[model samples]
Target chain A: MKVLEAETYQAGEVHRFEAAGQEFVYLAPAGGIFGISAAAAAVLETMGAAGRRMDELRAEMRAAGFSAGDVEEALEELIEARVLERPRTLPPPRQKMPERFPLQSLVMNLTNQCNLSCKYCYEYGEDKVATPDGKPKFMDWETAKASVDFFLQDSAGRERLHITFFGGETLMNFPLLKKVVDYAEAAAGAQGRAVDFSLTTNATLLTPAIIGFLADKRIGVTVSIDGPPDMNKLRVFANGRPSYDVIAPKIRELLARHRTRPVGARVTLTAEVTDCIRIFRHLTEDLGFQEVGFAPVTSSQKNLVTIGSGKMDSILEQFCALADEYLAAALENRQHAFSNVTDTIAELHEGVNKSHPCGAALGLVGVGPSGDIAPCHRFVDSDTHKLGNVFTGIDRSKQADFLERGHIDAKYDCHTCWARPLCAGGCHHEAYVRYGDTGHPNLHYCDWIRTWTDKCLRVYGAIAAQNPGFLEHFERRKAS
Target chain B: MKHLRAVNRKAVRVAGEIDAAAADVHALQEGAPPQPKPVPHYPVGCTIVFSPGWEVDSSGGTAGLCQPAERDLYDCYATCFWPAQVPDHLNNYPDWTKKCASATKDWREIDLVFP
Candidate 1:
């Protein structure tokens, strides 16, 4: 480990770049972006190299059209903004885990059974723990009601709540899902609150009736399809037959019918299915998905389809290629289908400093078909990570322990990394699958995440510089 | 200040010696002017009000508002209540204030959102 020496006025850790003829600085400490004036830029330059005394920096700022008082004010502002740094007078404080955090959303795992047995399916893969021997294969209406009530009660004073349906194939339990929607709507309505419904499906079981119901209820749908038939080699049926042909027409009907919320496509990128650009094209252009998101498959090291280091590098390159397309579309005030870039940019724009990997176990939790609660969808069937059962309340002690262990402060490897605010040590389930510990950092993707973050930073800088109005429009769309 | 139209009547004192009864020092109250017609070309669902300053508080005064305006940003964004200026973080930008621990100390990190 490298030691930092004492400094009077050191420059803060920042990524500086010029885009669209405007200079920008991404402040590492605060995750803030600032467009410096010429005077502030000069002060940054004068102190950029090494720490300098107040008198010394003031002398230079005086020459740059700043009065003595003005220079002092400017320096203080910079220090406050974390654009300039001073040695901490006190030791850094540890972040405390919040108690009594309310839940905002729940992921309901509809079933442990699936029609398609994707080669890298995490639910049934090597890493998966066998479903509890007596657990039901599909979630029943009673459990679904209990989960909805649990979610609403846990959310307490919340004006709105969200529930996402998940499963080996969410559509496998469509009848129950329909009942839960109506029940949840009436329940929330009685309480003078609103509830939003969304689901992730393989689309193989979607019928005209299902599509019409989804459209009428305005339920958001996310289809899990890799890409065109050629790219979806691993996403096959139980009998080892391809599934693209079956799902494509169904997805088309769903997209055509579902008009309230844009239907998104979630692509699982495996070692064999590494063609991100082609997959993105087929999903967004050919199949007409409003947004397409790609996630590298999560699996144990022994899983053959698990992406190794070399393949991960290639995936990063493909992600960057798609990001460039996103950038081009953004510059012209157009929407792009690359949800990864859009999601990251949104986080960057919001200056998200996550203590945990995500909202899992914090604002969100997952319920299995048997009413057992887990941290998230990925942990639904896993017997190891159950937080509690929906009938009983979430176990506070267990949840606290999981959060404390997963906190950024507990992740030693992430202490010095500037991207920790955005990444927060990567996905918890991925860490658990790869390292046998939920608290372990996903070291394999550190470089990839850092590179991808930098690319997004530049994309944000370019947009803030050239077409800032687009950012406003984007924010409005997101809010709406 | 030059472009802004003064909304309320107030006394303006010149910081210099002046004649007690000087022409510019009169305390006369002027008659109110007729209200102008609303702009016809303005789009519907517009929330932008042509007020004299940034915003007025519930009491119809600026004193009740948070100082420096940024202090109230997180409050407004968090609840998405009365989001006339900042982006609402409740339903829309739920993660907007995730990085902002204390708005007073981290005001610079607050994002600028427009209607």
Candidate 2:
């Protein structure tokens, strides 16, 4: 018996070895293994042509009564024997994107044009005045129909569609927006699908009429507001005017109009740490919103760029501390509350298996206007991570190739680390944009996970201590 | 009736053993005496022995040297006297007794239903 050991290879590096009278193939980063007997190698050359997912091959082998376990073991043996050529570094190839649960959410970019022109906006550039056509563009009826068609096909015309209106501000194309909603409602009624609509806006365009329409449709709203007016200093228009004051009143109006439906507020934190708690408290207590979350701006834009690594750490610490305080207050007051950081932590703790908690962005595909599909929304703009085009669907043969070549396949400290099962190497987009490679794990993420896990453990321990019979009580309640 | 016959056969086998082991073997050879076998062990709170063919006389039965009344079968192979307690002639072969004890421990207890 020959014992073959597991080996790690860098991206694009190729190594060859033979064992057990068979040739094997291995790819690093993506880490797929395949085996071919000496006699089968000749046939493999012909069969390995282009466009085959490993799943298809595995399925055929499974039908022949070769258990998946045995097939994988043989593949691993081939990998250890060095019969396969390991490629060192390859560009992200087109791999099959997992299409589970069908498509529930669709981001309809109403127009690439924005009113506030926030300094950290992804589309914000020095030549911000010009749209894609060198003029302000809006999604017309036909474009909206086409987008809806794409979504319906993926969803298999399923019920309960979640459509998100995105843009410089989706409200900029109010006429087209109304038309699309009307068309969607009619189409959904005919097809027996229930349509749920939501829009992410700056709130400056949220006039009384707009609020009435949104409230009438029972549409959920998430306004972009970064802390208080002063904290939102960086979020200004092209003329360098702060937009918080102008948007705050409109937000208040919408909140009053749509008090029943949940209103979510998003903040983009910069390096500023002054009065962070007060700002968060004002948003939570004074604004009376149901949920609040934040995403750091990517480092792509010129002005008001994302904070440096050191400052980013400080910012995250401050935000998390503020969130903890807010959550504690909400719990004490018995009020409805939501915090993304805490929610993510709770989810991690509640997961059944220690490994593979939530599906972060593994199978999720984000579609851009050009019909190109990226792994997630974060990498929509980065050409290197584009998996495939939705227009042609996914090219199965190229799926594995894309995954191997993608920046996400790069080496990260998280891969071999124990915390990997939880963090899953952090956000690939953040790693790529911030560290220049997707393979490298973010230390900030590690720090966050460690802090969150510690906090969760402490809370659970305290609860168990206070309520000694909590476990028995909970188990009994569940049993009945 | 068939079970009574089986029990009679077992009694005859015991009678032969008593003839070989007993000091008064010649008396039993002239006129056989009814030999009482030790009761078998059975689980608690259950009727183990049937009437007429077999009956339990004591709880532990024979000072723990013999099987308890609840036992289904009287495992004679497991019964061994202490070397100091038994006659020297019987203690001559220690290995044989040990093998008999192990064999008795391996025996299965089955319930025999009477017609």
Candidate 3:
């Protein structure tokens, strides 16, 4: 028989909160949440900041009316869960940056020309990153084919590949887009690999034939629309006429025709477009979109359409209100198309700890119209962030510098932030636009992101306690 | 369940005692309270009773769970060993961990389904 010996234990970092009338702890070391018992809480409280030896802890538990066996069991459970630990063993090493990460997806920029002259347009407006001179406005077939073959070759052992059509307006080069899809499908099929296709379109050029083809191919679609006519005043044509009337009917046709995949709306939240709920309702209830996601416009601080810090409060409040609705819907096992909340909740469910702001330039990259490779879609035509050309292949030296600089370890401010795992110091493009350096953290978004992450954590906790089964459903939804 | 027994022995011991007591009371005119038998392992479809379980282990106990379940989640996804509960990343969601190389660390990079 083994004899239990007295040992000293130090408590691990934990974020304790109440959700759905249950006390829970977000165990930082383990990156998991567990509904702790009253006894467990008592044990932690008694242990306090200085921690306690086994003898002291056992005596305290006995005084608190817990049996010896129960006390030992709880201690074992807590220790095993990593809520308590031996005084000092070296902390686990940080995740090392992989020497060679595989490529899985690419954002193919079909064109650099759009009919709409949206005021907040990142690609063509006042904040434009100066589209490099002499590049083709519309992607030619040769460049498109090389891009496809580049993706196939780069993502060598990967069984599944993904291509996302992007642009100043993706559908501007619809003819080329069709040819590229056909060529990619046949090319991928020959290799016994599967390629998933999706596209972000401005919806002005969605003809009946295009819509039918999109539906048949089951291509995922994200339509760029702000809201109802009044809200979309910024999204106007070169003649300064609102594009709502033109795109509305076309979007409806596309939505009506595209049945194979869920259609989503991507709203650019600027200074004027702050009513998230109103916009979400208009797009989901009225426009019949399956999901609606919002991104605060990222550009230079002086840009007129930039979402100001003052207005961020309102945006966050509206987000919280919508999140409450999402929680309500989730409790009943129904999905609410408030995608911002949906995405954050999903991240929380998986206990996400990000190393970079996003998948950009990691598993995914962007191919510009002229076959120039960039970090992501937003950087497609930007001369500064050009990674390489599809023909010559990715410049690993430049790629390494970008990744190393963007890594969470390099972000000093993020080292102490609890939400770093989710934000990873915020978007790389946003950081570059705001601070002129991709390595810089988006300090402007720190408070907003922390508050938002906390709220999402609460929502995750509530759903977990009330309807854990729904999490399983959500997991399946994401996986499927 | 076997893995649970190996991972958390004490919990299984306590649970086994409880199960045995219940079995003794619920037995149908049994002699010597019928000794507890080990569950036989076999190749089965989505074997929830064999390996990693969510809430309850094969012993019908709470003690054998992976203390913080996230620790073993990626292993399960990678091997497709336990598909009764979680998605098998090997087949169903191959791109699930494309950005998340280290499940214990980079779980945030796991992709979510979007339109």
Give the distance in Å from residue A97's predicted Cα in candidate 3 to where it truly belongs: 2.1
| Ordered list by lDDT, greatest first | 3, 1, 2
Interface RMSD of 1: 15.5
lDDT of 2 by residue, A197-254 (tens): 8888888788899999999998888888887777888778879999888877787788
Candidate 2 achieves a global lDDT of 0.50
Note the Cα lDDT for every prediction shown.
0.75, 0.50, 0.77
Q: Which stretches of candidate 2 lie over 4 Å from their true place?
A: A1-101, A125-136, A157-159, A188-191, A273-275, A300-304, A308-320, A323-333, A336-338, A352-374, A378-412, A416-422, A436-440, A460-480, B1-115
Looking at candidate 1 chain B, the ten consecutive residues that score lowest on lDDT are B3-12
lDDT of 2 at A161: 79
Model 3 misplaced regions, further than 4 Å: A1-11, A45-71, A85-91, B1-115
Per-residue lDDT of model 1, residues A354-380, tens digit only: 788899999999999999999999888
What are the candidates' interface root-mean-square deviations? 15.5, 33.7, 10.3
Docking class of 3: incorrect
Model 2 per-residue lDDT tens digits across residues B1-115:
1111101112234334323443222221122223443532321222232111123233312223333221322222124322122212233433333322332332222222222
Candidate 3: global Cα-lDDT?
A: 0.77
> Which digits, one per residue and each the tens of the lDDT, describe model 1 over residues B25-114?
121111111222342111111122211123443322333444533434444656545645666665666766667686545543544443
TM-score for the first chain in candidate 2 comes to 0.65
Assess candidate 1 and give its TM-score to the true structure: 0.76
Interface RMSD of 3: 10.3
The candidate that wins on lDDT is: 3
